[model samples]
Target: MLPEVPTEGRIPFLDLTIPIHWENHAILMFGIWFVLVPFAIMVVRFGKGKPTTYGIPRGTPKWAFPEVCWALHFYGLYTAILLALAGAGFAMLLTGGFSGSLHAWFGVGTIGLGVLQIISAQFRGSHGGRKAPTSDPDDRTTWGGDHFDMTPQRWWFEAWHKTAGYFALFLAGGAVATGLSQFWVLGIAIALAVVVIGGLITAVVLQGRGYNHDTYLSVYGTHPDHPFNRRRFAQMLEEKDRKP
Candidate 1:
């Protein structure tokens, strides 16, 4: 059995007496990883505007519906990162530096991955497409952007950012599990299970209903001349030709 924490006093650990606000820490971290972060991910995953050639003109105001999804995702994750740092800092301060425990290590790993996600997004290159202000819809020559051309920079950014974000969440699951093992909160534990199951069900339903559109097709459109589409089409033809 775990040792009981005394009221109005520090909790005893090996060679250390640490001040811990268990309730506050649990609430803050639970809301961030379980509630806010998942909401942001779900919104971006299923809330993209339907794939259309003219969808979301480049200069469309940021407050618009589909555009707002991106805003929520961008700002929501930023908020989570900041709050996570604050929570972790407070805990570390009270604990007098790292505890070198499993929970502590998991939290550190989760936060490190979260910070890297933000830094990677900053270098995602430019947005250039048919609807971009710098491009003319009638003239493909003006569509000269890293994204429009599927340049190496943009491709690598998407590859890393998308994959890393999910991996960070996986680490967060580990952190939450380990944290609860150390200081179990029944409410938070129940909420975590409900949220995970609900999120999976929601994703399956939305994906089956065709809500998970391709990022390129949703933002840029299905124009045959789009660089990415053209390349994909060429590759498909080559694969077909190689078949018996």
Candidate 2:
């Protein structure tokens, strides 16, 4: 089990070079971005593999973007744009343009972006928990949706979620690095810890479910709905071969 966090007090080993004055805001933003956002992504990626997993339908495009590919491309793009704008403000602050007005604008804008991240993550997770009919109009499959699972949907879905989890390291690493340099390391630390903890938990859960990496890859080796794709199909075949 993960160690129980003591209270809301400061974490140990705060030796990173950040100033404590801006601690709360920095940590708060990092939490929403690093933890909340990726959790939504994992939910969408993993739960959407089946028609009724989580709550999304079999054909739901929970993990898809623009009704086509991975949803990350869409949200990540929007997030990058917002952060770039914030970075511009940061540059202004760093380069003699930080008037009281400028500081107010950038600070408010940064917090607003953080708020947006949390909201978007919430919406994404909610989308994954969809227990709706497959034939619903909204259940239309896009390109990626079509590829969601033809074979053992759960197997590939787990792989996809884990891959996404690994990919998160890059974004979280950058958040930590940039935040630390700007004297806001606590935020990144929290975000990184969340990512690590979440991934390990999911991995353990999958093992409990009797999934291993090789079995996972084989399920998605080609069309998703083949022999390895459908658990029911595999079990039924096994039953059929047994003599009466």
Candidate 3:
């Protein structure tokens, strides 16, 4: 278990870059880009896997991914807020308004992109006829809805979301590099971390993009009449053999 954080003597956000609060800055920076961002991507990736062993007919995509996405969105949202707040704190402490550093600009860009992402999600509706039918009582695919955006708009939304995500991740890396420049982080270490993190995010996002309706339903079709049920089909075959 993690050690309990002491309530008293907590370093104020404005003191984030002070020598005494270096650890706080390090922790916050790592928490946002490394932990939260990767966790969100992994959770969505996990939804693309088969869940036959668990007997979850809807698989992780239908039942678990949305729930995870909902929870992780808060992480992304608040982290973006914290990034802005930290910048504002720094400005208040020293710069009086905004630091003209490239890092500061990148941080601002990240927050702006995150806000755009959130707004785009609000307009998202079903993707063409791709939405899971609600007429069936057993329908369990739960991510999009029947009222979702049109294909062309959804396509643009996806394009923007993916592009912005990558840009934000890169900007976060730049921000961390600048933020930690006075610290012990080596140049080589930063480079390696960026490459590894960027590669992983790219891979996971690509994998998620490949999980179209056919791919998803093939692995975990929950519809009552879907032909994807191998076990049920086998049983039916066995019963038919016995009947004659």
Candidate 4:
């Protein structure tokens, strides 16, 4: 037999009940974490342009196609975090407080990591490059942004943000699994399976087709004189020297 819908608690102002709140929370979190967040990550990962400056000129607006990938990732994650907080707040209010359950912990951890992702992004430093608005394409001296130079700050930020984002998604999956155990929603379960499998397959196909261009090269082009590229090339030469 299916589990009965929870209808005990009443909404604060309106005539709605706890089940409505629960459903809303579930839908919001599911859509944010499973659908929207995954799509954003995938787009940013595979939607970057080729590592050539032919089509994308210097000082192209950040809202353009290839650059827009970062914009989409930025806004999508911000929106997800905000909606997640709202959904979590609603759930907490309906339940009176945190119940210390495994699901509750998973939910809290996921939301916490989402918040950290936003906070870390703020410290990702500047985007100095030949393509930056502040940079002069002909003046290599002006292209000194943290990302362009691959400074320690930017490197650490990328390391934490990318890894933690994936970890947060893993926690979200745990939350969803535990939530399903409590709510027994067949629809949500099926949706989870479909979204996870579909996202994996799509990511694999895009990667196979060489859509996953290097982020640095995509944004700054393949100019060997670029600081990061220069450093990378030097490192490769050093490694080759050491291989003897």
Candidate 5:
């Protein structure tokens, strides 16, 4: 039987009438975003680099396809799990509606953006070029006899998916900061420190090995028009020779 305080004037810092249930929600949110999401991203980022450990040459685009597919599959599964946890947390918040509060709405927005990210992934298929094909069962290549065609729709989906991910991270940080503006000083500090350290490590690893999507594109092809596409390299070379 919590006190019936109306959602309107219950800003976490200003109101200072925190209930146990709200505190529970804050802890749940923190754990899901700070710990779980980052860990999943780290695993996908770093795990993709480990194909070299299994004898696949580093920076070889064709060899990396299977690893990239597996990484996306793992991330998609992780996103679904995070959505479920976020849904449960939001359900608890709805018991006493979070009307007119930045923290609540920001949290809701993060969840929505995350859902969009998952949907975007469903459309991520590799635009294929006519290259040497392998018979590996693990390779789920999107390329076929399309004559070096680049699917703009798939590229747009990937771009939006990445944009939504960045927004989700920003909203999660804002929600956590506002939610704990005036309470649990020590716990919040420790939790933030952990998150920052983990983030730095992930950044270093991603920078060292390279971002997965960009690396794949660089090795594969930007599009049929771009000079980087393998199909165009020979054409560019011939044009260069003819110029002088």
Candidate 6:
């Protein structure tokens, strides 16, 4: 609690009261959601076939990662935006304008997540492409190439991603439940937790099947790596040979 006495009717900078619910708001919305969204998306995308090789898409862009288990970019962006908003709101709260405990906690949680999002984006966007740090490097790739280095392995990357996913969900859920007292907020928080958890479980079960990395990189037809599968390269070759 901050001292209410202010000299000359002005609260001193050192006496600013901390927002009551900063941890819940910032940690939950930004911190948790920042990591959770991408994790959830990746679980669906990569886990579609098998946990390791990750199933290939029937039709996929050549630039895509085959075993991408989730799309964290969305979560990153959403968390960042929320972080900014919460920071502003926090300023108001500290200056004696706003004073909702729920709002404060959520704001703090969200801001923490926003910082994480920025860190992740910077790491992924370093090579001028949106490839994550764990993505496999294209065999023919270089610094000036159109892709970055990231690949799925049974060790580090998977562990980081999975741990982040579970932790984020828990933080987001618990923050809402414990920090906020409003009825509507409670309902929304519980609903969000349920949705995230359900989606993750379903996607993981779907991923147990064998995943083929080449499948996700094929453009229009079967992958060259696939036996008896016609390839897009054949069409490209044929088109190139056509006389104008």
lDDT of 3 by residue, 58-131 (tens): 32353365335435654665665567567446433543345476656766776677667677776555522123
For all predicted structures, in order, the TM-scores are 0.91, 0.36, 0.54, 0.92, 0.61, 0.41
The residue-level lDDT of candidate 3 at 183 comes to: 44
Which candidate order results from sorting by TM-score in descending order?
4, 1, 5, 3, 6, 2
Tens-place lDDT digits, model 6, residues 58-101: 33443355333333444545554565566555555454664456
Better of 1 and 5 by lDDT: 1
Candidate 6 C-alpha error for residue 97, in Å:
7.3
- Candidate 3 ranges beyond 4 A from true positions: 1-20, 49-95, 127-150, 183-244
Q: Clash pairs of candidate 1? A: none
Candidate 2 lDDT tens digits, 127-169: 2111223334343342122223333344444445445444444
Q: By descending lDDT, how would the candidates be arranged? A: 4, 1, 5, 3, 2, 6
Stronger candidate by lDDT (3 vs 6): 3
Most accurate candidate by TM-score = 4
Clashes of each: 0, 11, 3, 0, 0, 37
Name the regions of candidate 6 deviating beyond 4 angstroms.
Answer: 1-107, 125-166, 180-186, 209-244
What is the TM-score (0 to 1) of candidate 4? Answer: 0.92
- Give Cα-based local distance difference scores for all models: 0.83, 0.44, 0.52, 0.84, 0.56, 0.43
lDDT score at residue 136, model 2, on the 0-100 scale: 43
Q: Residue 51 in model 3: shift from native, Å?
A: 9.7
Model 1 CA deviation exceeding 4 Å by range: 4-19
Tens-place lDDT digits, model 5, residues 1-244: 1234233223343544433455555666777777767666655555543222113333446326545644554565466457545654554445445544676677778777777776676677643432325323244253342222435665577578667776887888887886666344457668887888878986887777656544344334444443235545777888999996
- Residue 47's C-alpha lDDT in candidate 6? 41
